[model samples]
Target: MSIKGQTEQQQAEAQLAVGYYTELFKPPLEPKKLPPPAKLPPVPQPVLAQRVPGAKEESVSGAWQIVADKLKEQILLRHYSPQTLKSYSIWMWKLSRFLENKSPETVTTSDVQRFLADLAVRQQVSASAQNQAFHALLFLFRYVFKRDLGDLRDTPRARFQLASFPFRD
Candidate 1:
């Protein structure tokens, strides 16, 4: 065939090939529509002022209650462990009970000394327990109540009696 006729035939074949490929590659059908997003219940907002430990103490009238709330605030503000908060709160309760629920403002170093002495001499708590109580009180006085604990020299020490345990390898 002539070059002109061959070129026309080649163009027609190219068109057919392109049409075949387009039909082969075409998408099958329309996709399924997506479901609408589910609506969620509204969340309640927290009361910012009441969330603070100090603000929650408003209804508490006792001196120790106010002091305890302050202690909790300090412990939380410093990011101390929850165990520390629990221990300190326990010791504070014990101290209040020991003082016959006296005002925290009126408690002095002597009061603390008596409490510690009672733990050692009367309650017979272990040295570690006594030390734990001491630290709790220390944090209370120095940080919470903002008072000096003074020298704790007069505080009685809890004596320890070691017991030997038999072991075999």
Candidate 2:
């Protein structure tokens, strides 16, 4: 337009025309503040497992505590892995809970069977977990309590679902 000798007024007008059309085509601005988020119901906090009457304080109270300590000692003496120690200890605690802090000496194979059944039927634990719990209890009975927990009868086994494999060409 300058080379063709258009006036300064003419060039300004042309730019203003383009600007007007751009403004007309432009999308409207989003609201600065979204309507205050919908009022939400208060979320409930998770309830922790309530402690059994005699389960707390491993020393001076629970008889299971003494057996638990012995189990730990035996596990350590055998140079078992930390994971093994933790799992065994956890299973022992669970047994204590199941028994309502009763003496481990009184726990027969039937009790173990019931606990394992609860894991499978009630708690719905996986195959490996149920097996791990079984082995842990086995160790506790055989070594710690010095009782033979022979043949846990009527024990519910955890059902493992195997994934179907694809055939290769």
Candidate 3:
């Protein structure tokens, strides 16, 4: 073919190629059947009072479990730090043990006082440790139990001990 004829033929071939490519994007005349989406199994929720490894199952069961679950819900709802949740969980567990699994409804300010005193006088925990315990318990009573902790003026205060240095002349 002459150069002009060859260019015309090439343009016609290009047009055909473009038309074929555009057909790929056009909807089919007949509807095609698509398989339904696969059904997924429901996810299991985490148990807040799940058993600790190598520990008795009873340790996390009973009334304490109810309190633990509620405490976790409250902590998560407020968007508190994980450390706060961990600290609160430990204090709640300690409180449960101290109360001998007594129902949270039965817990009183006096009970809290005694527990604080026990931590200070016997456990000899540092002031910061006792304060953290106090705050944890306070959060428990206020949020989890939905009750005010009331007056704790008589609670034995944990004393901060300063390091003593030997005097040199």
lDDT of 1: 0.77
**Residue-wise lDDT of candidate 3 within 1-169, one digit each (tens)?**
6556677779889889999999989988999989996542221222444434534435444557678778888887898877787888888878767766566678999999999999999998999999999999999998988899999998888898775445678
Comparison by lDDT, 1 against 3, better one: 3
Best of the two (1, 2) by lDDT: 1
Tell me the deviation in Å of residue 5 in model 3. 45
Could you tell me the C-alpha RMSD of candidate 3 in Å?
Answer: 11.0
- Candidate 2, residue 136: how far the Cα is off, in Å: 0.2
**What's the lDDT of the predicted structure labeled candidate 3?**
0.79
Best by lDDT: 3
Clashing pairs in 3: none
Clash counts for the predictions, in order: 0, 0, 0
| Residue-wise C-alpha lDDT for candidate 1, range 120-143, written one tens digit per residue | 999999888999999999999999
Candidate 3 — which residues are off by over 4 angstroms?
A: 1-60, 164-169
Clashing residue pairs, backbone N/CA/C < 3 A, model 1: none
Candidate 1 lDDT at 115 equals 96
| lDDT tens per residue, model 2, 1-169 | 4846988899898889999999998987985676885532221221228743442433323466677678878887887777787778888778777766656667888889989999999998889999999999999998898989988766889898564445678
